[model samples]
Target: MELITSNTHQNQIIEEDHVIKKANGNFIEANTLKVTLEHLKNECIIPVFSKDNESTISHYEFVLKTKEIVQDLFPEFSVSEPDIRTSHIIKGRIPSAIGKPAKELKEHEKTLYYERCAFVMEIPEVVENVNGNKLALTIGGVRAYNQENLFSKKSPEKFKVFIGFKNMVCTNLCISTDGLADQIRVNSLNQLSEAVEKLLGQYDRNKHLGMMEKMSRHEFTQSQFAHFIGKLRMYQFMDKTEQKQCFPISINDSQINTVVKNYYHDPNFSCSGDGSINMWRLYNLFTEANKSSYIDNNFERNVNAYDLTNNLVYSLQNQSSNWFLHN
Candidate 1:
């Protein structure tokens, strides 16, 4: 068995850049959040309301949308998913620069957790790009370029700018889903509980997404080693080391790449949980006052996600073996 390096560490390598810089004179807290590594459980959900409209929450379905979050991880990455059909639930699917009519999801025997995450935020108008024309920019499903996707979730609204990280680009499609966070709006506790149930259901559905990423890293690296290729087929690494020391087996790694790849690369695959931070609680910084960005705190990595780093993680980046960049 190959040794597993924790994703907690890989996540650390993926740091949230935070330097207090001025955007529009108001000095938006343009940095990572203050959550500690210990506080960030794989499924830890933190909910935040808009700064201008405290009564309403910003549509964060964009988080799980691969294109929405991919640049944060790899600024060079670009999303190619084009067809993402519109859900009649909203108006027709949002239009884009691509040709051909919208497309339907190419179902896999196995679905993904990000799909559920995408669904949670898809059901909102903000994710629908309501202010694109006013901004003279495209935003939402294909080209989400509106303030709601940016500024802190609160009342009256706060303005901020997020300059693109690298040579990355985005195209929006009018995608929407049923508000899984609508739990906050329920008049009765019972109805609210139903909303909570929907969020939990999505969370629980793909309990192994974390493990899958680790596994993919391993299998992908080993594929080139013809000698070991035969033994390198199983694609998932997850476990509980100190079972008695603390929490139970909370989740696993499974199909996370599928989720991200689909939402970021496959347009026909549009839905609620498209891989961007699929849940409302995932964006807890909204409640953070005194100025703080999301992912401010240091996060810890699980041990099972790093074995491949020993061999492939850095070398084969940009889809090729660039010797100058690696060793």
Candidate 2:
């Protein structure tokens, strides 16, 4: 698995040209917030009005403002409206915050845990045929509750930029997890534009597609594919060892197995006889698996599942020959 770092690492790689520097010079926090709120209204996620004993106020939160800035950079993609259709309810709890079920606390002592919320913006994809197979650059992102939140006065929300592939014909989301950290991250709004540019660079380079192209040239027998599945299952529940601990995320065995099953058995994954052993087919299988596990309002669950699956795929892709041979 690739070492994941915060988004700031990207600025070091690409030189800050005059355009970005000039934009930064022109950045006015108050004006930016105003512009961002207008964009949120465009997407129909209105700001909430709150009246408390101390004061009465109406304002947009950090999450909504962050969304507006992101949309401004990528005008081509449409923001999924922030309604039930786009929302996810994350499960689980911090044991320390809320004690075991057997214990009960006073009403005022109850903890406040809001459901995890996320938004995904669909990027336009560029598809190409490689050795009679399809390859694409699929891009999207996730902003959520736990990683970064509204409580912090200076830094209120967490935003992640992601890249994946979408099979043109079948429309399955093909995700390659190689260098996962360098591809996604948490960032401050000041670095938002630069971060978006870096992600766009990945899409332009066809980073994931290049890997798939090489894999497509190789062949995998049925037994080898099964062995790959076995490895993923193992990773699904493996303890967090030193080298393998990059992103702090986990997915259970049942969820992992379900995604693997759908990859091979689902009609969307069906390929021509010649397509059976190619890498694109394998990539599609796993990406398909990740997409199939979505549970409404289960934001954190889906995010963890996607991260774990991506890590497994990244590990497998990094040592394809060794893994394929051992199996």
lDDT of each: 0.23, 0.40
Specify the highest-TM-score model's number: 2
What TM-score goes with each of the models? Answer: 0.18, 0.51
Cα displacement (angstroms), candidate 1, residue 64, comes to 19
User: How high a TM-score does candidate 1 get?
Assistant: 0.18
Query: Candidate 1 — what's its lDDT?
Result: 0.23
- The worst-scoring run of ten residues by lDDT in candidate 2 lies at 25-34
- lDDT string, candidate 2, 16-108, tens digits: 131111122110111111123343334332211122122101112334543565467657765543221122322343456475562555444
